[model samples]
Target: MNYPLIVFRGLNLLVVLLCASLALGAGKPLTDFSLEELMAMEVTTQAKTPQRLSQTPAAVFVITADDIRRSGAVTIPDVLRMVPGMHVAHIDGNKWAVSARGFNGRFANKLLVLIDGRSVYTPTFSGVYWDIQDTLMEDIERIEVIRGPGGSLWGANAVNGIVNIITKSARDTQGGLATARAGNLERGSGALRYGGKTGDNFYWRGFVKYFDRTRHHGLPGETAEGDWDSLRGGFRSDWYPAAGEQFTLQGEAHQTRAGALRTEPLFTAPFARLNDEPTETDGGFLLARRSWETDDSTRYRLQAYVDHFQRRRNLLDEDERRTTLDLDFQHEFAPNALLDITWGLGYRVSRDAIDSGQVITYRPSKKTDHLLSAFAQAELPLVAERLTLYAGAKAEHFESVGLEVQPSLRLLWTPSTRHSLWLSASRAVRTPSRTEEDALIVLSVRPFDPPLPLTSAGNTNIATEKVTAFELGYRGLLNDRVSLDLATFFNFYDDLRNFEGVPAAFVLPPPLPPLDALFTTRNSETKARSHGLEAALSWQAHERLRLMGAYSYILLHVEPRLGEEDFDFSEEKTPRHQASLRAWLDLPHNLELNTWLRYVDALERGPVPSYLELDTKLAWAVRDNLSFALVGRNLLDSRHQEFPVESFLKNSVTEVRRQIFAEAIWKF
Candidate 1:
């Protein structure tokens, strides 16, 4: 069954359009909210400018800081499973292979990631090395995930999706705190943080964290045990020198040690893998922005930022450095029905050195990319505040891809104060990976009955991946105490590259003999679509007790054309159904109780086995400025796997059993 998102999108659009067109002609007029209210929408453009996810035309979800704190989960990937259409694979204690829609693996290349506007994808593998991205979980302000192309606003590598992690401002976390964690699986973890106000407008904070974990001890056979350790430290500072201008500085340094296994075809020998791989990384970002509320009716922002980061992976035996400088300015003349204009340009210089025996180089290679882009979006209130439409397009020029244009159109309507509807369509493109365009790998030739063709290494010709997406959503305040949010989306992809086998024969002579097959990069000429529905509800049952739950249903489809018909690859690792429940109950005294339950369905087949994870926390105010917390995760001792999946060893890997920890927090 071809579950193309477009088919559903088309139907949704027609219905929305017809309803909107008719409502505008026959319904009562609408009320225009204040700019403050419009901006109340969460800013979730994922690396784009600050805009509410509801107002943005793209398909996006925001995992707020409150959500993170309430979940009582340990890692970022664990929180990611809550989002539909995204594939999250917790490969091991210290590693995660995550992507959107599909193409999920240890090094998921198709997804682009940003830490406070700085790109974190590895140039060596064309993806983010999730294991290396570490920071204090408490420091995260919010994480915005977009499940479709964001190429126009964020250049390339966003083929499948994008993830942006935004940290909390120094001013928001002002105090001194210490915490320690230990459990059955998570043997040891600790954190220390301090922050203070430098002046009326300046605030600074610093933190240090260390973590050690025991690997999954599966059902005998000595199949799944590896140890992991990591040490990290970071600091952040924010300054509001004046009323409307702000300066932000943040940096982090970390080192990690983890066990790894090697893969080879030989069956008679034992696996001799690296006992432990140690990696160290350091990075920082500086940003300055000034905003002026010009005359109450007009507002504008001018901003610039610089990012410097470096990383060293033992397996790669090399160090990579990236430095980026960017400048942007935008203005909005508003009142609800007004004009908004935005434009920006950025420059990035990435330099690296490869040590011997590493995949990046026995030698070293360096390349710097330049990018220039301008974008403009306009919103018009047609027929008073009853109907509104927005259209925007981004024109970007990359050093390699030349010029690319991404355009978006959207419409929003509010039939009544309680009901709202929106529809959007957009086009985006993902840039090529550095490895596909530059890396050199040796190919091993093997024979086959069908007789494959062979070709040597070094293919310089590659093109950027592209995607077109459509989305629709509705929001309603069912009652004074209840609210709901619902959305659906679909995306189409082109020029997905995969390795293919070539026939090895008498094609070459001497030192380079022609082999039966070689693995080279080729365009799959494939198309993929993801259609899913996300529904969430929040009910304020009482002044101190609130309940919330969310559910997502997604259907992913992939079709490969232009040869290799037998390779029917569906986007794996993403479940079709995910449901979560959260409840906060306040008992008689000053004590509070929080509970969370998440269910992730298996994708391998019918009546898929879903995993249930439960978390509970009890908080007691110890003093005016201090509190104690008791947290228990996987309370069920759920022997089931958190991310149990096929490993590179042709078997499956399971996560550790249960964990319970006690923590304390202090504010001054």
Candidate 2:
């Protein structure tokens, strides 16, 4: 009855239904020649410059590749569900739990993902494995969600958000390209690309992609074996020898096969079941970057990367391999009209191997880890263009928290150019992985008559899972055809992560005698508090239409720490009110229509109920480089279950049917 008071009465009835739908369109009649071309958009993960998203002071969001081709999404967690305080669940059929603002599960350890600056999380279970994170969503080129706590310029797990992704260079993809798709649960897909130029200063591109999916429905709804498939390829090169120097290189490779159910631990007595495994994965990566600039306020960058991964499952008799090596450096300077600077340095090394049998193990079994980081950010202009100040700090050294420090402070206020205001304070951390410091698990076997074996151990003195955040933002354009964005937050978490159950009872006197029970992993002087509200609105509903909406509300409170009262499902499994609505039309000769509507509120621990979804896309343009489309997704549910029933794969609950697709794109 008290779900954070129904998320504050659904955010006060969504601010009175967004002021009665903007006072019923405030007497429409304003079209200063528009095709909804508002332009002025740029972001760079919060402060690596490229500002303007109404002068970002954080709580960012930018997902464009034409908003992922008009959002009838395909993958990337359904294009991050059009983001607004994200939490995109869908546990099986290629697992995803995606989080932001509140720790949603499936390895969600405070979200931090990147792909142009490479880092796919997963320090062996520190999140992000969204089925191998593919690319070619039309060469990305956007996607910069950064909700809260960026750990003073990205260090540590960036605490609660950060997903960069950025692609599309190589002179913005130049030559031939192709794409094809077919669906009923995406039963086929394809992609191919090529780009070239070598005359004056390099530029090259290459790509290949594939996909297959189908099979989901369980819990009496039949068919569920988690079907999946994958194949990939990639290449890139870009160089420019003059005017601000630049050089780059890229690489990719992939292979996958999936089918899972895997959950075994039985010794008769209705112990455990669900087995049907066949999983394989392979991975690759290579990256290099070099940059220099003398204008645009000075700049510098140098980067390096190499990664490799592998996984195989035979019903929890897993086999895994991982390798990583990374190096990075950054510098930016203004040194003039009121200072603006940035600095960075990082180094990483990871090596892993496991082939353990019988349910899990990692005690040493080959390991190597190292991480070092440094960061700095600064910008101060007391009133040069209407008050601004931002400061940052970061320091990291890992091998189980040997050093850590993260800091931030931000402020921006621009009373004019159509409003803006911002405020922030931050600190973030979440470190400790390798399955929480060296895995080894069992967790159950009790049934009397010689069989008691509950276990769980792996904790090299765990510590570090902290947050401290506060933010407030506002952005308004109110006159150029409406625009508004508001953000609010308050978070404070500490030492979170709990488990400690010890009830010793062991004996092995003469020949043999046995009994066992033990559990450990704690550091929860538990404390959690979360508060939120996010709002977005954009309207240009005239020249060829455009409308956008977003809403989010979240509330979490926890105290525990004294005999931890069952940790109330860690924020009740996400979704404390949510919304998104979108529309875009521009038809007439070169047709295009897009739609998206969503609402979610109800997942109090997957008592999974509330839902409302509708996605659509229809396109046409058979000339300037071909195009055709049709996409429909969950058109009001024919199956649901976004997540729940996954605690070690308890049948990996599934169901997310209803999809339709047909697409084609070509360019030459």
Give a tens-digit lDDT track for model 2, residues 1-668: 34455446544644554454455444432222232233357788888657777777877878778878878687788898788999787767887778887678777778899999898997776777788788889888788888898887778887988999989888889898898899887888888999998988889999999989877677554447778889999888989888888899999999988777766665346656666866788888999999889887888989998999788883365788888999989999988889989998899998988876545667877898998999999999899888899998889899777999999999999888777799999888988778667876655566766666555556888788788999998886877778878899999888877776554444322221244444555454677889989888877755456678898899987776765533323777888888887767665567776777777788777577777767888888879799899988877667777777755545567877778889998898
Question: Which candidate number maximizes TM-score?
Answer: 1
TM-score of every prediction relative to native = 0.81, 0.33
Roughly what TM-score does model 1 have, to 2 decimal places? 0.81
What count of clashes does model 2 give? 0
Model 2: pairs clashing at backbone N, Cα or C within 3 Å: none
Give the local distance difference test score of model 2: 0.77
Candidate 1 lDDT over 543-657, as tens digits, reads: 4555667787778766666444212234545577777767665553456667776666785621225566667888777776677778887665545554444432222255646
Query: Number of backbone collisions per candidate, in order?
Result: 11, 0
TM-score, structure 2 vs. true: 0.33
